[model samples]
Target: MDRFGDGLVFVVALVLIGWWIWRRFDNWLHEPPSSRLRKLAQAGEVEPDEAVDFLQEHGYSVLSGKHRVPLGVIVDDGPVQTTRLYFDYFAAKEDRYYLVRLERSRQPIDWTASGLRERLLPYALLFPECDGIIVADPKDRLLRTVRFRVEDEKA
Candidate 1:
C-alpha cells in the first residue's frame, strides 16, 4: 500500500506540472503584441504627405501622422480650460521611434536649447517611450533629432 500511495503522488505531481506548463504556453500564445509593434503594423494605414516624404528622405520611416492630444487644465481650482497639442508625425529609424514636429511659419520653433526645452520637451515628456523629438524643417531641407537628459545639481 505504501508503494502504491507513492506512485499515485508522483502521478499527481506530474499532472500538476503539465497543467502549469500548458497554462503558460496558452497565455503566451494569446497575449497581445507590444504597442510599438502595433504602431508599426498600423503605419501602412497613414496617408503619405509632404512630412512623410521628408521623413523618408532622411532615412526614417513615417509611422503615423497628425496626432492631436487634448488637454484640460485647471488653474488654482478655476474653471477648466481645454486646449490641444499637435504632433505632425511619428517616425522610426533603426528601431528607434521619434515624435516628429514640422516647423511652421505661424508657430516657429525656437532652436536654442532653452527654447527647445520649452517647446519640444513637453512632447518628449508626454511620450516617454519615444527616443526623442525629430524637428523636420522640410522647407529648409533639414532634419534634426533632439534628446533630453536630466542632470542633478550639486550644491
Candidate 2:
C-alpha cells in the first residue's frame, strides 16, 4: 500500500476505536433501569409495579408516575433556557415532597453518607422546591435518602 493509503487506514482505525470506547463508556454510565426491570420481570423476582409498591410501602404516596419537570436556567446567552428534569418517582407523604432517582445495577448503588448527600445535591439545587430526594435500585434492593433543605428565595 502507498504511505498515504496506510496513513488514511490508520486514521480510520483510530476513529473507529475511539467511537467504540465512547459507546462502551456511555452505555456503562447510562444503562437504563428499565432493562433491569425487564430482567426482573422475566425472572419473576420483582415486577416494575413493585418500584411504586416499594415507595408506597415506605409511606410515599406517588405524586407522579414518571414525569419530566421543566426548569429554567440562565445560560451564557443570558435568556433563561428551559431544561427538563426526569425523576422516576415524585412522591409526597405527610406534607413533604420526595424525588426518587433510580440507578441501574451497573451504576454504584452503595455510597457513604456524604457520597449519597453529594449525589442528591444537584436535585436539591435544581429543584429546590422539593422537600427531599431518594435514590433507589430495586435490583440491588437499596434505598437512600437525603432531606434537601433549600433556603427560601425571599431571604
Candidate 3:
C-alpha cells in the first residue's frame, strides 16, 4: 500500500509539472510581438519612420494597399468575424519588390527573429510583387532580410 501511494504521488507531481510547462509555453506563444517593439521605440533605440524610409530611400516604391480579412468572431455569431488591417510598406525597384516590416524593440535578438518570422512574414506575402521581406528591429539596429520564391502565394 505504501508503494502504491508513493507511485500515485509521483504521477501527480509529474502531471503538475507538465501542466505548468504547457501553460508557460502557451503564454509565450500568444504574447504580442508589438509589445516588444513599442518598448524599443519608447527607449529611442530606433525611429519608426527611419526603418520605413530606409526601404523607400533604397528605390523601392511604397504600395498603398490595405486588406481586411476575417480572423474570427470574438464572442458569438452576433458579432461577425473581424480582423484589423494595417498597411504593408512595399517598394518596387526594377523587377524586385521589397516588402519592409518595421518592428522596434529592445528585446533579445532571438525573440525578435521569432516574432518577425511568425508575424510579419505572412503580412509581407500580401504583396504579389514582393520578392523579399525585411524585418527591421530599430532598437537593435539590426535588420534581417528574408526572400521568398515568386511562386509562393501572397497571404
Query: For residues 11-117, could you state the per-residue lDDT of candidate 1 as single tens digits?
Result: 99999999999999998788654464445436544687777888898899887777777899999999999999988788788987888888889988788989999
Roughly what TM-score does model 1 have, to 2 decimal places?
0.71
Highest lDDT scorer: 1
Q: Which should have the higher lDDT, number 2 or number 3? A: 2
Better of 2 and 3 by TM-score: 2
lDDT, candidate 2, 49-87, per-residue tens: 878787777787765556565789997879998987666
TM-score list, all predictions? 0.71, 0.50, 0.41
TM-score pick, better of 1 and 3: 1
Off by over 4 Å in 1: 1-45
On TM-score, the candidate that comes out on top is 1
Q: Cα deviation in Å at residue 46, candidate 3? A: 19
Candidate numbers, best TM-score first, in rank order: 1, 2, 3
Report the poorest 10 consecutive residues by lDDT, candidate 1: 36-45
CA RMSD of all predictions: 8.0, 15.1, 18.2
